[model samples]
Target chain A: MNRSSQHPLRELAERTRHAGAVLRTRSLETRARVLYEALWALADKKAPSGRHAREALARTTGLSPEMIDWSLAALPIEQARLLMFAERAEDRVPVDLAGVVLAGNVFVAAIEPITAALLLGAPIVVKASSRDDAMPRLFRAAIREQDPELAEALAVVTFPGGDEDKERALFSRAESVVGYGSDHALSELATRLAPGARFFAHGHGVGVAFVVPPDHDADVTTITDALAIDVCAYDQRGCMSPHVVFVEPTEHVSARDFAIQLARAMDRLGQRVPRGPLPPKVASQQLQWRAIGEAQGGLFEGDGFAVALSSGFRLSPGYRNVVVVECTRDRFASAIDSVSRFVRVLAQNGQWVTAPADCRCCAMGEMQRPRFGETRDGIPLHVAFLKET
Target chain B: MSEEHKRRASALIARLAPPHAIPREDAWRARDAHLEALRAFQKAQIPVYGRLSERFGALPVDVLRHARATVHEASEDIRVFLTSGTTQGARGAHPFRDLSLYDQAAKAAAAYALFPDGSLDLCVLAPSEEERPESSLSYMLARFGEWFGERVTIAFREGKLDLAALSGALERAQATGRPLALLGTSFAFVHAEDAFAERGVTFALPDKSRVMQTGGFKGRSREFTPPEMRSLISSRYDVPASFVVSEYGMTELSSQMYELTLRHALNGDRAPIDATRRFFVPDWVRVTAVDPERLQPVAPGEVGILRIEDGANVDSVAALQTADFARVVDGELELLGRDPDAVPRGCSLAIDEVLSAGDGAT
Candidate 1:
């Protein structure tokens, strides 16, 4: 409720709006090139700016260096694929100015939205999360190297949320607003946006994995390995990170048995990749969740991960904690439906008889590395920033 | 009171009213015996505990896995008190079949840990039982007022602090030269302080004035660390820091613990009392800090999840575990904040409010 002086944000938004007009006249190819260059800049670790950006990201977001590097490596592929998909669409006109509210849960979350805005040729004004203010700055640095003109189109602002006046100034000037946060936060932000402004709300959502174990018993380990990677990605902080894995009962294996295997795989992956240090609060929640599951007689824990067989699905506090629930064909639909409101992506080993309509289904291990231009929460990110003309 | 309730209350009080000078080993043996008896009672009476005993071992932490379970039978005459659900929205219910026992435990604990000698004028910075019948804190304060045989001045009404009324009470107490006792959550004091400052009002109570600030800021407001709060209370009320006690309690338990500041002050220990250094647990309650993962007692001086073995919770399960982290020093608890990621629990419901206020994602 503490409002910072609104002059700075208002001034920045005005500048960004001016920049947006210049950006909208640019060709799609030029926008794509800018993204490609920024991606290359992010990977140029030898460069001082790149090194500084990486270090700042690591410190601010509490992500390990390896995880930051992995996220940076994936950015180029994701952006290129998005650009390719966007080119296929007709009747696409970039919004003059797009406002993006980025979440701080993952280190590289800003890159996707920023790149998507570029590909759409929309100058963007970003409100970076307090937890990771370095992300937008880093992206801006990368953009400057690619094209100083494109860099001028992006403005990153930082302030405590809930300053209605400052937020109103930003929303009123923008043609569209895209926000990523909890359902509550998205709704609250939506209420603040100006009438007639396009709003894209990516509310907090969870990912789950459905493993129909291979008909043969030998391939279980392979399935577990893929599932482990999905869980380890972003330390299960991203919405696409699996919190619960629904293992379908197979002739050779029970869901509990598969959970044990998955736990082992998680342990192996933890040793190889190693989780970043957990904030004390997160560590305590993880410990409490595991303890409660253990006391109930169904928890299997490894060094940096825990897999529990629970009757109901509960979202993990992240840090590689997962719940594995056994569901029969009859119960699978109802089980997934119960948590449908929060389900973003459902990664499965094979096909299911039926799946939720809204969630994007993918092959195991692909939750984190979705095929380029895949719809998130049923919305195509490729065209999200475009206004049909 | 029902005969059964009276019997249970007397038995619990007899076991928990011993002097603090009892040797550590002797105290432990007595506590273990009482805990064993309480566990047996819970297993026999509470079906959930019975199932937990069969499934997991009879450890208190294990039994508390079903903290949210409705364990009381339908036939029992019970008052169901719901937790504030500071962590998650699913509130834990603690049912009491015998109100008399709860009152007895509350009174005894307050006497030993807070008042000790005699009662003072009661001014509660919370709602009355009539306003919030389900609040254990309001109920406890009402009981305290009854014991003190004074008209309780409720400083908060309709979810707003009545600053004028609180200030008036302080003024009246000063005018009458009567010692006063202030009781409320930490946030209530902060709000009072802010209100007083805004109006340019300050008051120094009579010489024997004391305060019992319970409940931490559940992320609803800017958190005031214990020292900061002690300083604020001491400066505002003209009471020394040693006279400002912090009471540690929750809706789940019938008994409570108080920091020994008031006791030290009463004992004429002129040396500055670091209230944060130790808390006085009543004889009826045992506080243990256990490794969160293992649910086993952590080494003394190490921080861990706080587990309570409260003998006073006669109608419900006696042993409970909380998501709060604390350290045990010389058989006394050094209050630590709630586990950062631990689902918020308590009457504060601050987390739920903050989340609803837009801190949480879908």
Candidate 2:
């Protein structure tokens, strides 16, 4: 082929085309082995690249050391589950090429789609976010150590956003494009994809925790501790981080009282997983939100982390800024109705409650660490990204 | 506003606007008294504030936060001003039962900061009150127009800039040898400059010509540093950088801050306006930078959240806190940009490591 003046991305697409064909022919056993080995590589903390990945992710993302460790600890479990999920799946047909625009909110966030594409036998070309260019490389390194042939199918590239020519090159050739970012960014990227290209957009989302009154005497301290993790993990930057907790009133404690307990727990947790210095914008937003919450008759305590108790249904300005809105059973359901559109996960405590069909209801404190094969944003990852032949 | 409210506001204005510089202690005392009175008024009249005070310490910003969406008014003649809302679309609505207080504060602050030599030919680059009745900026410009009388010209209408009308007014002022004042948001000026550049138009106004721009880009447009904006204003209008003052105000507060540029320019001070340029508050307003988490005053020169005590805001809450990060320098407030909630921590280091790993070969 005469390739002078051809876009550089065309070569990248062409290189991945054969890998895509190879992926389709790969057995489920082969895929499971690759995934299991990759998981083992990630879990190997003694490995130099593994240690470097954790440190780099912690430093770049500004996630506390504990938060970084938590993410690293959770990844193996998630990947192992993905391994089992792939082993069970039979109708896996790989697309020619899949393009992924990963978000930098959390370092491990890049793994979700990358691993999903790998599991489904789709060759992926990832455009890593500038905020987190290290993560994709780390994943690629792990995969290469485990299965070199599988690693060839994945490509991670970094470029400044809004580069039209490069973006068109990627979109024109890719059978599917997955974008993770703010709603505006996702929409902007969606507009650039060629006709009939499969597009999956993950926009800004918030997670909320609903504390149902336990049948037994509630250990408020333990519950608060778990909720604190949900709030403090990734400094509440991830979409799965709990922004608000709606507590159902109990004989022992009122919803507002639970908020106060949650605040104390957050304060204690701050010492263990100290919140990193907030960026100027995040600090200002947290302050503004706190001020607004206070002015509106909400109680606010702005320590290293912030807690607000109000009747309002507004999402907390994430960065360990947690809002506790008091709600009865009826009001809790209604509040869910109002915020359901933006809620990605609803972490629940006490009794099992019916949430909006779209939101995933998990046990409290498990919001941030989603299990593999679980539907993210109510879309089953195993089947959602796969195309039927 | 009710006649009674107007009378109270007028009396407060008289106390605020002294012919000469009042003692700093006296100014602070008056401010504290006004704040206490306003707090008392809100607690009695606004149920939300009353509840919040009972729960949390009585901080005006705290009270304002609690009453963000609710209408908190002591009187029936209330006008609600809403914040532009965050990306999440949750706007904080502040109610003013007596806008006469707001009008008086705006007029007096403008007189001191913007037009110490008295109002000249005024050209506002924002929409009229009729066009955006809900906008506090539009309302303030309308008040300025009233203060400047018939010579006031508005160059923005129906959501568009009337560059022709602005150019005509500028030319008329130039021909008449009359000093002019151009007022608008920073983005509006950027738009005006771009428009003028497209047409190869520039102006050198009279010696005392001044420009007052407020409301930083707020991420709506590309942001220009203060020095950058001053340079653009200076070059485009042939006005000295010292004469291009920035107004710092928000809808939540009746009072405003202005850069000392106008005063410096009128005095023929050739000092170049740099990033260190500080905004001066009127005698009636006390501006302090407080730690965001503790809400305690930070040491001078340290960046902190801004909290204001404006005596002019007699009808509404007098104490307010804003998201703008600022620091006190030599008794004046130097604004930094809004505090970013989170800074990407060590991306440069990661990038370096990645490059060294030869992963950047792609």
Candidate 3:
């Protein structure tokens, strides 16, 4: 297809390879300039504003635009501040990541690591996810207009997945492969990859919101809104999305009331914005919660609020809507334990202020990833390739 | 419901009728409920609803409210199930406290499906016996057995398919040309097709032949499109693909959706259809076609998430939001596929891919 010529992936990969060299071998001043130039190129393409990227990223990561901007804007600062973490650099560790098999989630994933890849000059073969399709297509169009060589180096192609040969071939050549998928899927992928490769695997981890008894009369709306961040964001598709919301039935907001408010908040968003479907499995799950087998049960769901199945239907890994469950904290924990094989864990309103040790999800570094870079088996990141400050 | 009955017939006979025919008829046209009314067996304490009342309240309407309400007046949502299996899995135990209102859903469908043979020998793809309450397939087969009588078949045990007995039965059925209506899964049927093909036996099912391929398409090699599946079977038999219908089922609701291929739309044979589980959606069902991102419904016909509020399910508050994407065609939902843009993080890519691939939205 001449379309391949219109935006040659070879050229894109080459240019990206060049840019990556600059990113990896060049000084911080050069890195800063390249990022700034990339920004300009992005602007020249007349692609999308940071707001559009922000929204897309938000939809993917579940982080608000404000949060994204704050994060990205703070990226320069995070970089500068992280300059102090020179002590934490893993360059000293003997490691080599032959390539990173990209899974699209958010712009941050592509952009953040590109900085490191460019700086470290690592060869990365990215398999753009459908989410990245829009960004890369637009960006490729932009790059073609401004400069085609850079686009070629990126070699971002959309191949139908399950082409095991392609993936195995790609993984076979790489010393390290980084990717994100559900714990179940990622572990399977890990099995297929070179066993010796240092895997930067992102699978699933359960995210639970623990409601603490706040000292003040906290606005139920406030707690509900906070929980909504993890549920409604990305329509609860991200690993970061809250799967089970643990409320005391007596916390700052009663579990029943919290669920009601949460559902209302989601409804408002759904009506105002209407989140997408629940995850495929979750959608199919449509929790068939029965009180018959429960060790203890009895709770109220406020008007419009319904306690949902923890493992109900997941249409595209999203909530059909919210299912608010009311139970003892231990039961809640146990229930979560039953399903939280590999998922993110969240503590809302500083529930972390109480037994931080009891927090099921603690790898704080996993939090910011709205999409991609998820863990499948809770495998710790023994090393990461960071940009040279 | 099958407890006392299963004792009577060691072999549960699930009469095989296309969902498009039976439930659709019951839901759309049948006057069974109107001419011969059904009173709530338990009123607020329906027997169909068992322990759910403690958390959700009464039967029927309370279960509907459990998932439906405004700010929500229910609590402690629990495990999930598929459509046909829920009531039967746990001994016909409804999620609510009321048990008497056994399917208070007055038959709104009955005219569509013709029960020419009230009792047909049924072949199913579920477990032959009881299993963990969570086994959707097992519960589903049990329900089918309860509904029909003693003519039942199973191909599963310990979460594995029993292929040998299964192949032999299909072989016998096909070779004899026995007037048997096949019921089970699309995948299992496909396998049977291959097995018969290998044996050089033409599975020339009878003219009044019907197959109710349920949701449990487990134990199949690949996901076969309806057209492909039809071709595979039609190669051996003269039956129309229209007779091979898909049964859409979920554990959350005591309802099933069917892909009732048209026998002949020209013949004003539109039967009673379930408003909740339409061959496609009717006006009664409020569907929210979503964009997922702007968190808003897309332009009509544009693909988005499919959310439903069928009053048929409101009795149990089963208003649903799903990640399955679909395109609206003259109000009928053409299930395009799952949205791969976002699946839960770290979920198995293969299972996830299977969910997204052609489970595809248009």
Residue B226 in candidate 3 has what lDDT?
A: 56
Q: DockQ of each candidate's interface versus the true one?
A: 0.15, 0.21, 0.14
List residue ranges in candidate 3 displaced over 4 A: A1-24, A32-77, A82-87, A90-98, A101-107, A134-155, A163-173, A183-197, A218-236, A248-333, A348-389, B1-125, B128-177, B190-210, B216-222, B236-362
Question: For residues B220-259, what per-residue lDDT tens digits would candidate 1 score against the true structure?
Answer: 7477878988988888889988888888888878888887
TM-scores for every candidate against the unseen true structure: 0.74, 0.80, 0.60
lDDT of 2 by residue, A277-380 (tens): 67666665666666556654455464678787767566655778887877776777667565466677888775545676667788878888787767777666
TM-score of chain B of 3: 0.57
lDDT of 2 by residue, B254-308 (tens): 8788888777667677766664788887666777887766567899898888877
Which 10-residue window in model 3 chain A sums to the lowest lDDT?
Answer: A287-296
Residue B98 displacement in candidate 1 (angstroms): 9.6
Ten-residue segment with the worst summed lDDT in candidate 2 chain B? B345-354
Comparing 1 with 2 on lDDT, the higher-scoring candidate is: 1
RMSD of 1: 6.6
